[model samples]
Target: MGLSSRPRCQLAEQYGPVFTVHLGGQKTVVLTGYQAVREALVGTGQRLADRPPIPIFQLIQGGRGIFFSSGPRWRAARQHAVRTLHGLGVGRAPVADKVLQELRCLVGQLDQFGGRPFPLALLGWAPANITFTLLFGRRFDYQDPLFRSLLGLIDDVMVLLGTPGLQLFNLYPRLGALLRLHRPVLRKIEEVRAILRALLEARPAPAPGGGPVHSYADALRQHGQGGDPDGLFSEENVVACVLDMVMAGTETTAATLQWAVLLMGRHPGVQDRVQEELDRVLGPGRPPRPEDQQALPYTNAVLHEVHRSITLLPHAPRCTAGSTRLGGYLLPEGTPVLPLLSSVLLDKTQWETPGQFNPGHFLDADGRFVQREAFLPFSAGRRVCPGARLAQTELFLLFAGLLQSFRLQPPPGLGPAGLRTVPAPAFTMRPPAQVLCAVPRPRGR
Candidate 1:
């Protein structure tokens, strides 16, 4: 509940700039400024690259996937993940087209509401389906049972990870294990692993000579044949990596989109300006294209402002791989470090009026879109999100497409003053369930 609670910037004032938090008998130095974050994440070499041992990820992933795995195994898997995403058109037109299609579907769904107050119950599904299609070459109907189950399992994992009990367990692993206190958590992890295992086992093997199989599963099956070093590309890695992709790619994008909708509903002038820009640029008949982003500076600024205003994951955990000096403190090998990303986003020195919802933060005097170094929704350095580029493209396309087709507004009598964003508090900082009205705009207006 770091920044998930009301008055989200309280921690920044209380902690000054940097502070220490003790967890699991470890000292985690929290970097609150852009300079400090750069020093810890970018300046330091692999000395700060390793991840701390988390019992849940370790138990389910078995140190196979990119998120939980470390050292050489992590390096190989991450390399493969980046390459596979690129080959599959992650940032390119193919993926953008797929996202556009999904945005069309979302627009249709909104239209069906007919300006009624209907909750977008778990809007994460749209992006989740996109990631699923990209990784597994499959998409589930919105009401599909298996799809709902997968989403539930993912939500459970995120919630469990953020629980105070789990944090305490990370500190006192032996004691928690001695009491069999984490059995329920272990069971949930097993459930997800079992689901992934079944999916992996059901996949058909690649044809002889690797005649170009589709999907990450197929790619892993093909490369896993020769037995990668230490079996890093084995079935286990494939399952874990696929899970990582879905988990990482799905909720974060969806949550950010939720924030966008919420923020727009709160500010009609900002929303009107965005719609005007969309109307002037793309018009109502045509869908948004990636190239059009350059022409839509205000729209792009709003997107950036949304990311800056609401950070998805406030802090990213890192551990020192070797001895390193940070901010005049000598940190030993394996010391835990928490890069306070929200602090950076809300750093007064870097941002003018850091607390307000102002799109001007991303715009220069001439009204050109300018990216700030401190504006990093996706963490920086070696372990930066592999899906950053892909997610950005999707967000832009989907956001633009939706705004172009329909006007998002609050329900009658529930104006901007009534719209409040209560934090849902999980692995990500998501807005709580709320309903908004989507009024269809005059076609081609």
Candidate 2:
């Protein structure tokens, strides 16, 4: 089945442009058409600003983090995070430099594989490392015990969220609690929270007369002082916010990178074109810079294509703040609403040849790169992904740098490129396990 044939997108397309799905006793209105999504997410504003209450998130984060929380707590935390990211130069040169350094390290690691089919598991490490640097003012060795533990925790949480049992629990929380079946999941949450608490506590204190610390932790500390002076920036909030950053920043970016390599292996001609652009713009001896992106239209287009093909996180779950009209239907306040992003992204109305992996979707008649309003990978409106800018910077740098240094291919004996991606659903969608051979290119090739 094609990617769009997945149950979620299929349901969205079949149920008119906007309709409600009854899950347990709750009603979730899902928006499929572009106009409907805009109306629900942007036009109504705060009416659709709240998030659906996920029991797992509540048990794990205590509903204190920016992603799940609402009202004053969410506003303060989200504002602080955005401001802190700006202060750390997230979309500027300093952050780009950091991303480029990690990309270089990643290229070196892939080069070590000597064109053999190496697992892409290692590919996840670099982006996750970059996130750690931004959040804690430090990076970890690939084999660091703490880093490995954090990755494991992330994986477990994602699996739990995706499991059918969890969905059933979300639908019937009282029964789940009565049978004592959720105890294990609760225990896992506590364990992860404890580790996060320790890490936040152990973070180094700012030095005397420090002008501004560049880490996410420093931002939290600064915000704690004035913004939430009454203890709203408590240790729990700090831990939850930091964990949210690490999980959101790392997992989604890494998964996209993994998909890019897989797609390149399946379509060598496209891969070659990307490499050609990298060579012409970056040359062989030096690494690619963020500014060089303007000169490499095809490479940029390919990255956008990968994002479109792999619609990360089928939809963004939201809730209505009050009774509002969307798609001519009355949606009551607190009603869950899912803006089906994949539908809008792959809608034939918006994209030409929506089913194919064509980079031209992002290009103009003259081959110049162009932006599409329907590109909602980060979703739209006030509740959009906070790491959107940061993730875009990382994706471009890492993808271009890798293609610049090596050519990815399948092992000779391996069968036809298996584009089959395992659907590991979570707060974000993830790719299944896969590997590819990364063959290093000769200098000045």
Candidate 3:
């Protein structure tokens, strides 16, 4: 938490980008700065592609799902998920329609407040529902008991997974497990699995009209039944895979959306520019499309800035697939490496203003969008986020649509300066809890 404002990059000044940390019983390497992280993750290439065995994730996934799994299982499951998610319209225009639909639903929810304060958690619903639509082939009602339960369980899991107890367990598995430190989150995970099991069983015989909804579950069923190879598609494995997609697809995207709302509220000048661009290009009530990004460079840059500045996953752990040398350091096979992505995103050499919320980081002199090499929020190389395009599409539409429909602001007795932007404790870097007013806009169409 102390590192929130200080940033881990400053540590590089004292220890260089490639330094070692001795955590109780484990000795791991920390890769700071853009050059060092890139050299380790990209330069070493496939040899650094494996996920280190973090005890917490091992308990949750058991090396079965795509997000935390390694070796052939990770490779094959990733291949299958990419093909299936693409076929389900993840990176294509068809999914944009569904995202826009959720935006309308979200707008309606915000309209309920009528310029009153609303909880920050509500912002997660739209993005999370979009993820559910992919996993179960349907979206859930915001008020549904099952939907509410699932979200609550996910909340518990995320917090628990980031708790000190979990970290202690990771460093000393046997001693921590003896004290039952892992049970709380593990119990919550089981509850989630129960819900997933019911959803799998209750699936419609066919996919409504498209034949299996998005049919991700159905695809897994068929894949498991065939060849009888490694049992990667077994019923338990299917549950884990679906669990990975739901958790991965929901939390970070929703967190980013929350940041968008909070940051726009905090910086009204930036919000005004975003609103002007949306109003001029998209017009009132038109809803944003993926293609609209080309014409909405300012809005695009703000959204990108939100991501770059936040540094959601500060340092994702990667294990060496085999022994490899990086930055003149020789690492043994299976060594755990902590690559500081936050440093890369905020590299002094990369951004003109590393600490400020400057959309110009992604803009040229003429204000056209420009991709920077250090803008690696999704990381890179063999272990890059497979759903990167899907996430980008959701973020652009949801963010643009929100700005089009309303002006986000802090509630009564609060001003923009009072709005808290501190990093909250979670598996991912979450924005602090806040209640803000989403005042509706006049269409003037």
Candidate 4:
């Protein structure tokens, strides 16, 4: 929740890759850089993949959801979610189509400003709607009050969870409860739960052929039928699982794209390079397709650079399972772990320009898109983000579509040097509130 240049970086410099830190009297192991984090998380993921219990999250999710929950329940819910998303065409054309549909709406919405200053606040709704379509088999209109309220609640929870007060609450649950410090977050969680409950109730049951309508909810209903008398697919877990996916997917992606647009608008030279690639690979009047990503390497590189530069999650939360030795230290069982992804992204040894927005980190000399091992935005190991592919596809298509349709510009008299890119402190690091103009590209070169 601190600024992007995590204080942990200084700690790593002083204490080496794996050092012990005391947070609220809890002894936790911090893993920094690419090598140490990969070795601990990927090499020994089984022993280090568990989640430490946070009092606030324990109260909010009750350890029922896939995220923040470990052991059999987390395993079952995660497996089912992956299988169900694949069954519903998450990694394929259907999801791409849904993303493109939403992108068009977003582009159209941007056009209404007519080159005037527009804040990218509502930009999150587009990706949120994609999750809505995937989970409940429906999309919310941009102007829908219910949709706005739902997003607002999600925003409130994200912001509240990252506050220092929440940390104090987690440290002393009884005292914080007496003080009502976590009441706002608790209220927001309940509101979201209620919304999920209503959506689940209204969802149509699975058909004989197991059709796509209400695919996720239907699959959860079916999966719950054959499990143990009480299992992860219970009505409660269903809502929690959906909430996990929605919360996990929506804001991170929306923030990523928001940064994408901000960086592009700020860096017009890079934006021009991306537009050149888009125009060369995709002819005039042609809609950008997912397949075009390979041909438009610079565009893809820009997106990857944005992911790296933004440093979305400073550190991913993880914990140890059994006693294990890592980084030449014997970590006791249940040791909390914070794999500093920000450290990895900005590792001086890994990237030539860690702080700057340079797409070359992901591009080869031949100008082709290349993936670096140090790039762990979705994290690594067995607990890596399950929706990585889905997120990538949506990001590429939406980014290309936007660049194809519009030439992003900063506000009048504000150039790249004047544009501020540092993100505000939150659950997810998001670009600061700012205005930009999405000037439409003129017809044909």
Task: Give the per-residue lDDT digits (tens) of candidate 3, residues 45-112.
Answer: 78988998878788888989898899988888999898888888986777888898998899899889
Candidate 1 lDDT trough over 10 residues, lowest sum: 1-10
Between candidates 2 and 3, the one scoring higher on lDDT is 3
Clashes of each: 1, 0, 2, 0
- For candidate 3, report its TM-score: 0.96
- RMSD (Å) per prediction: 2.5, 2.6, 2.3, 1.8
Off by over 4 Å in 3: 1-8, 205-213
Backbone clash total for model 1 is 1
Q: Would you give me the overall lDDT of model 1?
A: 0.79
Arranged by lDDT with the best first, the candidates are: 3, 4, 2, 1
lDDT of 1 by residue, 277-310 (tens): 8888887688888888889999999999999998
What would the TM-scores of all predictions be? Answer: 0.93, 0.94, 0.96, 0.96
Best candidate (score: lDDT) = 3
